[model samples]
Target: MSTTTALPHWDMTVVYPGLDSSEFAQGLSQVLQHIDELASFFAEKQVQALPAAPVLDDAFVRDFEQVVARYNAMSDEVRTISVYISSFVNTNSQDDLAQAKYSELQRGLTLLAQQATRFTAWIGSLDVEALIERSQVARDHAFPLRKAYKQARHLMSPVEEELASELNVSSGSAWTKLHGNISSQLNVPLKIDGETKSYPMSAIRNMAFSEERDLRRLAYEAELAAWKSNAVPLAAALNSIKNEVNVISRRRQWESPLEASLFDSSIDRETLDAMLSAARASFPDWRRYLRTKARLLGLEKLAWYDLFAPVARESKVWEFAEASNFIIEQFGSYSQRLSDYAARAFRERWIDAEPRPGKRDGAYCASLRADESRILANFKPAFAGMSTLAHELGHGYHNLNMLKRTALQRRHPMTLAETASIFCETIIRHAALGQVEPSEQIAILEASLQGSCQVVVDITSRFLFEQNVFEKRQRRELSVDELNELMLDSQRQTYGAGLDEAMLHPYMWAVKGHYYNTGRSYYNYPYMFGLLFGLGLYARYQQQPEEFKQSYDDLLSSTGMASAAELAQRFGIDIRSESFWRSSLDITRQDIDLFEQLAAQR
Candidate 1:
């Protein structure tokens, strides 16, 4: 019942009670000395012994693990400091020293990367299997590290690898930084209610969900118009980055940018193919859902802006306390472990849920060292924002599940990472639908359909854009016109017969920051892959609600160790088989049909 105007401030002192703590300074000094020792040892000779192998059972192995443990402890400390500084900058961008420290920390990371790469390459030459075979934790970790070495090793000769690590501080990484500056600096000039106004991309985009159709339409038009002014700069950055990917992929003898991405993700080709096949097959059902949505809004056809437009009688104000309780209770019914995590997340002040000025534009959950997670959000206390909260809590739960994992194995692939978060959102929303009145049910259904379209349609468009752009960049640089053309073409293909073509967004590629990562290519498909995969898992949950909980928890916990296909195999599902994806789409289609029937009955 309370709407607190000010968001609660996080206490970073939980990690380090004071910046000047003797404990921290001593730990830092110890870690730096260890790194110095490692560089000294490796620089002196080729590896005669492996590092950190408990199985080796000699004085050298003991020395190595002790140093590694200390290094890891310091690594965690540095990351925690960087995270706190970055989060502070997100809320207070005007803090020049915070920004400066953030930049310095990133540069420090690049230097650390060179050191780490040299050590890893040295370790790769050793008989790692023998050492790991002696220790269970080491044995469990061998494959993932081996995979990393295999991917990066091919990309450069020993000298080139070392050089690239050093030069990354200035070249490809700099272009990404330039791209971020352009986006963060953009301002949209608009005419609102017969008055001239200026808006940020974040503010104008949020207007697409305004209850007033006139406001939504005006905001959409004004937003698109403003992007025209900065499109050229954004396009150049895209071309430069894509060109960088093409050049590097070829130098490394990679078949394609996508191949590099898949290799890095540790997912096989057949598995990815099956995920795409499932998404394409469900287009008809999604289209049907779109039509139902249009009819409910009394529009002849849906436009891009209208897709997220709030439908009347579907708008509801959900109090934060009630929403939190609802999510906890529903998730508890699914698994007590999940419920306990959610409960603690809220009670422990782990979540920053209130909307405020100077806060970052989106939501994220940052997993801290050893059994802790911090969630940051600009909460509006609406149904949609609550869903975002629940979605992020799902991420917190994943962190909790993987708390015991070593830092190295804990970094799961992006595609598999979405499983728990989306599953939590589904559990909460679907449960709310069952308990709501018919009108409210209609609203809930609308929101669900809207999200499904984003994963399927919007994500497909991004995938197509990246694919074509990479191909074109391989041949030569694409002009702004060419990029715009590709963006529109991709939108038409994915959003076929659903969206008003004239209203399609042609500057989408220019705006989304996902494309700016130099090392990570084809970041688009992961969202679609994650969504459908989670939906497939949700179907299993429905079939045997009691049995699915433990297996689901096990799946999240094992993400650090397994591939997408391997994880699916544990549930008796073959990810490479198209039929498994078909089943997930079938569930989505059923929902679309139900929405249509409900609309018709009304």
Candidate 2:
């Protein structure tokens, strides 16, 4: 529909001219100095050990609050430094200086974290509710304080905690970084139009969404071969990271790694179980959709590679400028606040949309500051790419909504992180469907359904794979072969008869970066959570358009301050109930029904 010769790149000058800039150096120095100041203040108070006779007088509470306030201030400054360095490295992972600076900042942050352990441990020993009631500052930070106290049992001694932090720099973190380096540099061999060429794994993977079936199959085969070549080292990274998590979780007295993840997610086992059960129940509808898709493509069964193949012959190619304007307009129709934020993001060069060498494969939106958010994506002139832009911009909009809150209050759990992003994506997608010609409806519907299936079916498979990996890692280290087997088994169970058994992806674990994070386990289900939750909210909006906007805004604003369950409760949503999840899945089912009807017409 629209075309452009060049896409946009982020203006990092707003952050710093370079890592060598005076501002960058000064920021790092200030962060270190603040950490030293915090360490000195706590050490002077002799707060490193548990007090034999604890007292909570007015003077003590005032001084404690002052220290906490100072800590929060310091934390904000350090976060600014961390966010800039992370953004730089994410887009330039191969840069040695950026990588070195990231490591340095990580170590500095770990040291600062070690210094805070004493204060946290002291807080843990105190009566949090009484403290909150007694002091205004404590009341203001009740959520974080109470959470820290609840987590006190899992905290090791200050020395042990520091050692763990230091070890992670070279252990878990290093392994994950190595995996990133390896994956980013991979070149998959694909034969396209009688020419056998070696392309970046990312480019080949993008071909999965191509309109050409033969090309998709070729890309899939090459991608699998590439992963198989590096499976051993990738497996090692996975094993090491999971083992670290398993040991730390056990030492922290968690029942299992999953329990620790739940604690971090601020959700309980009951809620996760309910949501997963609901997901399983919706498998039949998803399978039916898959069958319909296969028939439309003239295949008896769909292969893993065919999952994203375009169902329509004519695909729309949207230019970068056109897509951005459309998204802004669509967002404006819903809320001027959201549209304004998206407009600012594009106008201020907050997004990097160009594809280049040594860049990361996936897309993400980084909240660099309270008021500033940066998005990184590899843009193409396809509907899928436009959807991606909307998704990342959705994250930007979420960050925009949170600009007024404190740093601590702006940090939402992963479970609710995708709410705004998915919501925004859905907005643009449905709007496109409504405006497109009847002949173009199937492609639009297929694209939407592909995303839905990913969040539901594929995410379920990842959850199952990670669960099995954790369970098995507790007994012993799993070999590369075992990991492949486990992944294949998980896929079989999740995809069922919908996907061709002979063509299912066995190297999925090697490709997904989710499993490599040592601090977070079971990082898959949140997609399912975010999608279903957003869909339910979207459905609610349809019922009462006038009232839902403010409610949605309020919900996004409260994400950082409340738990998932608490936030859902604000909208009268019982996230712990199967019926609530079913309501969301029912919307997806309706889309599938429409897709089937359209395919039949074709």
lDDT of each: 0.74, 0.85
TM-score of each: 0.91, 0.96
User: lDDT score of model 2?
Assistant: 0.85
lDDT of 2 by residue, 1-602 (tens): 22466888888788788898898888788788888888788777655546453678987787777778777777777877887887767776788888888887886887777766776777788888888889988887777778778887788766787788789888998888988988887877888788898898888888887767888898998999999999889999999999999998887788999998887788898899999999999898899999999998899999999998878865567889888988999988898888888899999999988876667887999888768888999997777778899999998888878777666567688999999998999999898998888778888888889989989999999999999999999999899889889989998988899999899988999999889898778889988889999998888888898988867887887787878998888778999998999999999999999998898898
Q: Model 1 over residues 131-226: C-alpha lDDT tens digits? A: 566555456677665665475455456677668766766766777766666655456676776898777666677778877788888888877776
Error of 1 at 227 (Å): 2.2
Clashes by residue pair, model 2: none
